[model samples]
Target: MKKTVTILLFLLINSLVFSQSLVDLSKREKERRARLKGKTIIIQKGGDPARKGATLKTDPSGLAEETEGLDDLTSLDRESPPQKRMIPKTENPPEETGADQKDATDLQKLEEQLRKAKEYVELLTLKMNALWQEFYSMDDMKSRDEIQRQISETYLNLQKAQANEQKLQKDVEAR
Candidate 1:
């Protein structure tokens, strides 16, 4: 049984190798020619005279004289017209009405908002530092309420800062 299995395996491997060996250039050419069997080769003396004649028929005269009568072909050589003087058109200047007052008012509003936001951020940072100190203190269980309060305050301040930032963006865009 072992001898028969080994012989069968050897035959399979030999057959695979022989199949690959038959795929040479000659076989590829034979398959290509078989596919092109019904096609006729129209070889003229100058090799496909139709394409050459088509290109020649597109323009009888080559590129040089094609533009012969394109623009003012007559050689009269008359004096050209005098160059026209082009005066720049008049435009109304922009009007500036009470811009200074508006700018000052907007500046004051922005400054007040920035100052309030800064104070809120500073308060939040101080609360965070206090919480950190309490956490790292010798008595760990103490001041749990204070730490939670500080975290809540920080979250509120962050939300306020985001709101302020959005307001500032709107102000800039309005300008």
Candidate 2:
């Protein structure tokens, strides 16, 4: 049984190897021609004729540009009406309106709030990490419970700070 299986496996591998071998160009061309033998192959040449030296244009071959109402092409070059003198701008900038000033102040305040929120979040994260470390190191069950409670409070505060930061960011972006 092993001998028969080995022979079959050898035959399968040999068949796969032979099937994957690249054929010569001449053989490929002969096979292509044989497959196309019974059909009439029409080869259509496209684009502008080479000998005519005409530019290759996408417009229809026979359509000419409209010459009517054009009158004369050089009429534009004769003369034009005199243009108005341009007013040079003064360098002194326009004063900001009260609303604009208020908006600027609001944006500054929101930016400050966002910065504070980020700092608060960072502080809470550091406190929580420290509490967790202390909780893990403490031998007393009561102290560990206390540290865990503090960690939970810090986590809640961090969540609030993150939410406030997001809100402030949105307000700042809106400005």
Candidate 3:
């Protein structure tokens, strides 16, 4: 009687475990079979269709025919001989010589100076914009002092940028 009760308990536990696992197992098997079917269908139809909705009902044996034509064209190309050509070299002017390395260094330096000047000018322009915006937005004496200070700073920056630009132009011309 004790052995019978123990066997019954084991069977009940086993049934519960199997019941929980059955759903997942069936879902996995279904998905696997679906993927297999898709592969079989793709192989039957040669390459994938141009459009998603296109069917494999049309003749799929055209791929073999196309390959046969390609083979014939390749053979024809192999039978033909390539052409030969004669070429001549010519001498050119002194400009053909590369530019001086010193000139290149000077050009790079001038470019750096120009970039710096442009950046300063852009900052000054932004400051001027902000000052104008503040002046227009605020009334009477409220924004007067700050706006005046900003305008003076912007004018100084513009002058500095102008000087730098002139120096860069001289350097470039000298080069």
Candidate 4:
């Protein structure tokens, strides 16, 4: 009987608290609306208000008649059509120096190799981590040995990639 009375009292308190919170929110909203009741919003962009709906009025007879004024920009050709500009064909284009071009290409190759080496090192590092995780999760001796070997191989490859990346980086910097 005590438990029933306690549960009923808890439900009644919770309902009262929730209803009071709703009333408080509504009161705040009413106060906010009252504060903004007499306010007005206005946006002023550019341009003169007197010329907002005005447009340029051109002479209708000036369409076909040529005018002597310097501001006359209307051109009407009631004749044939327009012609395309003709370009003369050349047999040979000028060639660039081999040494300059070769050096740029070499630098680009070194940079590309460095980028690939960095990516490979990152890949190998992930592979090494996965190998270690697999080794830790397993209990079989043969599988552990296999994973150890793979870890060693990945470590070696990672070292090689790092060295290659360092060498390429130096070469790129020298260029």
- Candidate 4: RMSD to truth: 28.4
Task: Please report, as a residue range, the 10-residue window in candidate 4 with the lowest summed lDDT.
Answer: 72-81
lDDT of 1 by residue, 46-153 (tens): 232232111111122222112112232111111112223354655973555688767866876675565545544543454456556665663644466655665666
**Candidate 4 lDDT by residue in tens digits, 26-67:** 999778656545432111122333222211223432222222
Candidate with more favorable, higher TM-score: 3 or 4 = 4
Those runs of model 1 whose alpha carbons end farther than 4 Å from true positions after fitting are: 1-96, 138-142, 169-174
**Which stretches of model 4 miss by more than 4 angstroms?**
1-96
Each candidate structure's count of clashing pairs: 0, 0, 0, 0
Best by TM-score: 2
Give the true-structure RMSD of model 3: 31.5
Estimate the TM-score of every prediction: 0.35, 0.46, 0.39, 0.45
Candidate 2 pairs with clashing backbones: none
Report the lDDT tens digits of candidate 3 across residue range 73-103: 1111011111122335456523423557566
Model 2, total clashes: 0
Which structure is stronger by lDDT: 1 or 3? 3
- Candidate 2's residue-wise lDDT over 3-28, tens digit each? 99999999999988777664565689
Q: How close is candidate 3 to the true structure, as a TM-score?
A: 0.39
